[model samples]
Target: MGEHCDDEQVVVKKLVNKRYLLFKIDLFVLSFVCLQYWINYVDRVGFVNAYISGMKEDLQFKNNDINVANTCFTVGYILGMIPNNLILLVAPPRVWLSFCTFAWGLLTLGMFKVTSFEQCCAIRFFQALFESCTFSGTHLILGSWYKESELPIRSAIFTSSGLIGSMFSGFMQVAIHDSLNGVRGLEGWRWLFIIDFSITMPIALYGFLFFPGVPEHSSGKSRFSMTKYFFSEQELQYARRRLPARDESTRLDWSVVPRVLKRWHWWFFSFVWVLGGENLSLASNSTFALWLKDQQYSLSHRNNFPSGIFAVGVVSTMLSAVYLYKVARSRHWHVATFIAVIMCIVAIMIRANPIKPSVMFTAQYLGGVAYAGQAVFFAWANIVCHDDLQERAIVLASMNMFSGAVNAWWSILFFAATTVPHFEKGSYALLATSISSGLVSVWIRKLQNRDSSRKQKLSYIDANDMLDEDDDDDDDDDEYDDQIAQNHS
Candidate 1:
């Protein structure tokens, strides 16, 4: 009993130390990563805010020109995914991500110089290539720092931070429109770019100084040595010990091609996000702003009204994250989007038959539930592919990449700003895509269950027990599976 008590005390000591280390990670790492998302979102979506505030008038954007420019951002987004993942692997995130952030801020300021649609498109394409790392790259980094159980809410918080930025952009635009319209000899919309650039510079510098790289590589690197100020060598070792062993680092090679192709994860997760992103078009493409524009609401309304969707987004994203955190399955990830699909269906009904403005607006607001799936599916990918770092990186990036690939044209086909009032075709497209996404989620669950069962049957054997001494070997996955089952807590 005395020995047992001593052991218990040792375990308690470790837990206390581990909690301290976790608090530091939450403070420094998650906070900066979340800020990166928030700023990236503000800069990325601020275009629409500025557009509605005054740029549409200044730039003389007509017909579908806004849609065309937005498509260029998505094109650059898709192009950046694979390469950005490669960059994160080779370079410290402190350098790679912050440089990208700073570059986009510079591009945001460059918006002031653009006088034509072609120039605007060119700038957005480059800005997007820089900003593209914010989402998937953070997910890749988050997966490195967090255990599966701890990830969902953190992912939710991170995902919702971008929504908060989207929400803030509207209010910021409204404020700028009122106060800064003619300041510094620039239009209110141009001032928006100037202010956005101003805000992004400090954040870029902050990330460069403080962003902690992943634990596996942090030790013994000249760049990361200073990070020891926040976490001691002992705590860093504990951070590693608390998680699974790292996979061997290998150079990017053709060997990864066949390995990824053989796996179900890369296929299913990537494809699901593509459909899900399309299905969420109403929120993704700023349908509320479009509706306000068609109704000829004032600039104030355009800037203030779209924020309602963003507000709904916070609640739905948080609630959905809580549910998925508790349940811990990709099978349930589609629920939020499914609710949005119902809203789309109801929206179609209202459009076909005349309804009060309040009723249709309510339906559109409910579609913010679709944004909740962002945290859900991304967290799911992290949970399922927790063991393989490279595969996880590729899969996370591909999920966003394929989704952006689809979105490159999704807005054009469905949520084109010109189609704002009724958007009959868009409603139909969303309905179809949402249904397809739900089916895909169900299929992914079926596949996971099949794989889990096969692995369980095979887990009874010990690979290590049969191995010879001093030979390099793979860790037994049975232990990983068991720990993972409990990680949802």
Candidate 2:
């Protein structure tokens, strides 16, 4: 009787321990990813702050050269994204991603010596190349660890960290400009890069030690090594089954590409995120603050004010994450996108109209919620594609790559140097895209719901003839895999 009682106690203790572990991976792992993203944005924006502080004068950048530099960085990001994702599949994210992080930190520190426009452009180019791994890579990590129900809010929290980073950069710049302007004979801009590099070094070291490579390839005694980290028993089984057995070999099956691309959901998400990407560029790139400073606003006011947009982003993202987690099964993502579209339209309207700076700030803050919509949208894709590994990867990368490519030109053409204070054309384009984004979101949700219903029907029929149907399904999957491999070859 005492032995049985002790066994009961052990079981209870295991259950309790698992419950505590429920949120550990999400909280710490997500926060770690957020810190990386935060630092990524901080480094990207340090150049912007430096430009405002006097880097433009010291570097003798032409009026259009800053735009040229930004364009170059975006180009590098776009070029690297797809290939980097492929490499991520082959390499453990921990080893490759941490190395990338450290390399970029060193590159960011090297920004201190950039004296000409060409030098600045070159560093920014390589910086974007190295830093491109964090965004979609984190999304992939979140998808690996969390269930569909738990993904949206977690991903939003992750994405919002970038905005938080952007917000914090303003405060950090203010402190740096005031305190480090001429310390050690280095100018404020030099200190900005130096400090930015310093902040990321520790995070990279943490990642090297901690980040689980891929969910299926976890090493012994790490955070995700335990069975409790998976959402369901079946999920744990699925992760185990993804790895090859002792007699089997693990190789890149190039054939998975067509299977991924053939899905309608992939294209829909890519299109949706293309619009969503514009929101980040408009708000998160320090454009609003830079525009305000260009109009001669005091540095104190400029720094303090733009952060309100991130505050709004945090609230909206948390709310949307909760909403999706609760009602995503019913296909309610369009509702969130609809609301974001409306807010964006209102922002465009305010930009078009002459308004008080405070009112304009309010408009921009409200529009910041649209940024959360992108997070929700991408997380939704991860949910829809959760069962298909290659599909999930391709969809996530394509969404970001297309968005980056679009924003690359969009920023130069619409939100150019001359469009400050109003950005009439840019506002109009945003308004148009906002409306289109809402429409596409609604349509895609409808299509996905239909597809889900079809899949559910098929599952119900198969359940009645379990063994026969299971064998057939396995055969079908193998055949599909072969077809995909052939297409790739």
Candidate 3:
């Protein structure tokens, strides 16, 4: 009884230690990545806020320039996505991610000095190269430290930080335009860039000082050895053991290309996001602000009103996370279908040509529900591809990479600045993408079920084979015992 009680006490203590370890990971790892992503969104949307505030007039912008600049940024984002994620394998995430953050911060500051639309495009293209790291790279890192059960909420929080940043950017731009418009011979729009740079650099430094790299590769001897400082040896080992077992034979090499190409995970997930990315046209393409501008609203109203989209996004994203974690059990396809339904309603509301301001506002804000899929789908991928570290990294990156590739042309073709105040073609396109994404999500669920069934069958077969071998051994032992008895007689 004493030994049994002691065993129970040991189990309780281990659970306590594991909870403590998770707290530290949440504090040091999750917090830094969240902040990094927050600032990344701040910088990304800062360009949009700036354009509407005063940069449009200051830079003498014309039709299609905004679309052209966005295309440029998307191109650069596409170029960097896969390579930057793969780099995390060869490089410590803390170092590489921090360096990218700092680099983008510097480029954001450089945006303050742009004199032409062409120059802004040039700077944005380069800024995008570094900014591309946060979304997919952080997903890879989150998958590294979190279990299947722990991922949805963490991913939701991570994604919501960016939405908060977008919301904050609008408010920040409003404040900066009101106070800092003419300060230091800079327009309020330009000040947005400078302030974003200021907010970004410190987060980069924090990541360098405290962000733990991958558990499998954490070593005390590395140049920026923050993992050892933040985590104990036992905690680090527990972190490794807590995750789903990885295939040790899978190495990060050229062979990974063919391996990923052959797998349904890569193809299905990549195509899902490609369709999913376009589903974001209403909010992502800044249609609210464009319609507001076309209606000739004040600059402050323009910036402030559109933030409602992100505000709704924040609430929906959090709620969806809770639903996914507690109720849906990571059935992301349901969330995807729900988003499609909501977005389809929004697109129809807009396409129906409602003149009422409240109607437009409701439709636009409801569009934010689409942001919920960001966390849901990525967490689903992480859980699906959890067994392969290399595959997880590549698939996460490819989802974003392919999405960006499609957006490069899709936005210009569908949600161009010229098409605002109605965007009839864009509306039709959004409907198509939303329905297609829903269908693809259902297909993905079927594939996942099939794979799971296959694995279960294999496990059952192996277990029966082992049992058969044991029975044969027992029969041989009995025969030997009978022969020994005969010899003795």
Best by lDDT: 3
lDDT of 2 by residue, 1-489 (tens): 999999976543332122233365655567668889989988987777787777878988766677888888988888878777778877777777778889999999999987789998999999999888888878877877765545666888898888788778878888988898999998888899999999989989877676555557554345533323433343333444432222124234776767766779778899988877775666745567767777788876677677788888878877777765554233445555665566676556667662467667777777777777757777777767766766667788888889989988888787786677677777777777777777888888788767756753211121113222234434553444334322211
Model 1 ranges with Cα > 4 A deviation: 1-16, 219-226, 245-251, 327-350, 353-355, 456-489
Q: CA lDDT, every prediction?
A: 0.78, 0.71, 0.84
lDDT of 1 by residue, 1-489 (tens): 999999976544442244567788898789888898998888888899988887888889999999899999999999999899878987888788889999999999999777888899999999999988989999988888876656777998999899999988888989988998888778888888888999899988888777777776663345643576677555665565555454566446777787677999999999988877876677778777877877889999888887888788889888876775555353454564465466557546546742357866777777777777888888888877765777888999999999999888889987787786787787778777777787788788778777766653323232223324322232443344455454331
Tell me the TM-score of each prediction against the true structure.
Answer: 0.88, 0.83, 0.89
Model 1 misses residue 253 by how many Å?
A: 1.8
State the lDDT of candidate 3 residue by residue for 95-169, as single tens digits: 899999999999999999999999999999999999999999999999988866678789999999999999899
Give the top-scoring candidate (TM-score).
3
Candidate 2 wrong stretches, greater than 4 Å:
1-17, 221-252, 326-332, 456-489
Clashing pairs in 3: none
Ranking by lDDT: 3, 1, 2
